[model samples]
Target: MYTRILVPVDHSDTSAAALAEAIRLANEQHAIVRLVHVIDLAQFAWSANEFLDVPQLQSSLRESGEKLLTERVQQVQEGGISVESELLEIWGGQIARTLVDDAVKWKAHLLVMGTHGYGGLTHMLLGSVAEGVMRHTHIPVLLVKATESK
Candidate 1:
């Protein structure tokens, strides 16, 4: 019986599936759902390198992240579910670390995420956020493998 469910969305199709699952679980348990979107500062840093002021670029990134979160929050709220949203602009580090930190901070009972199937070399080269979260967090995690879109 989860009272607080955390759903991390990156606007990907896989994430959308995860969000839907989270909503279903929340609805059944009458739980509160928290939607979190972490803006990878590392990605923004690359953009900053091309510009003059890094700080200014960071600010712009934060604003964009906030806007994206706000729109998603609105959509979730419109579904008639009790929801809270967060847009975290964390400095480049580890996505898994950031996600687990937020889950603990919010006291989330469950974590629902979508897994973008990555193979050996690909998985090794591009770290899997879900894998990191699962390894570090004690909370229960339900991973939904990405479904093909028709």
Candidate 2:
């Protein structure tokens, strides 16, 4: 019964699985897919050195994020699913928060994302984005766990 499905893709294999699942669901339900890719400059801030300009790095990151979103959007569209996409840039804060906000903005009925399937110490240390979204978002979230490829 979902009219809009929000998918957060990060150009990872896990994310690919999530997107594929979203597309299949969208096709089945005759819904629209809203794909998002967030460019958080904070991730690269520490890598910025005396030789690198923060502004330039941010721009580069935005470009790559948009490219990733575009590729996903194209794939979804080709699958006969109605699709739209956005490239977001946030200076700080968790990516999960950003996706939740975007889901509200787009009036998404569902959220689909990829989880790394980490537990215990690793989960505590890395902090799971999928877990954060599941905890904070109001809509139903479907998490697809991605594992290492051989």
Candidate 3:
């Protein structure tokens, strides 16, 4: 009986698939969908050091994040589903925590996300965001894995 669904989309194929699934489920139950995109500030911060100036770099990154979210929101709205979208530009270090916090704040009954699998050294080096969200959030999570590139 999920009435409020939170779909965290990153414009990835897996996320798109999850959004489609969420749309179907929402339509069946007449539920509200909240689309969220988290802009990892930490990643931006790190990249800022490589740029000419921190302020300029951060500004560019923020603008890009906003544009990306807006486009995705428009796409979702076109599907004839009632939707609310949020763009959370949080410091990169606390992405997992911030996502859980937002989910609770939104009072989401379920969270749908896409997972890009990491293996070997990569997996160990960059931990799993989906796993972190699953471990921390009280709401149920539906993870859709990306299809292998042919």
TM-score of 2: 0.93
Among these predictions, the greatest TM-score belongs to 2
Model 3 C-alpha lDDT versus the unseen true structure: 0.80
- Write one digit per residue (lDDT tens) for candidate 1, span 36-86: 888766665575476667777667777877776787677667767899888
Pairs clashing in candidate 2? Answer: none
Model 1 weakest 10-residue run by lDDT = 43-52
Which stretches in model 3 have alpha-carbon errors above 4 Å? 42-51
TM-scores of all predicted structures: 0.88, 0.93, 0.86
Residue lDDT tens for model 2, 1-150: 988999998978899999989988998899999988988888767763667788788888988998898888889989999898988888887888998999998899999899889899999999988988988888999998776678
Measured over all alpha carbons after superposition, the RMSD of each candidate to the real structure, in angstroms, is 2.0, 1.6, 2.1
- lDDT scores for all predictions? 0.85, 0.89, 0.80
Considering lDDT, where higher is better, how would the candidates rank from best to worst?
2, 1, 3
lDDT of 1 at 53: 73
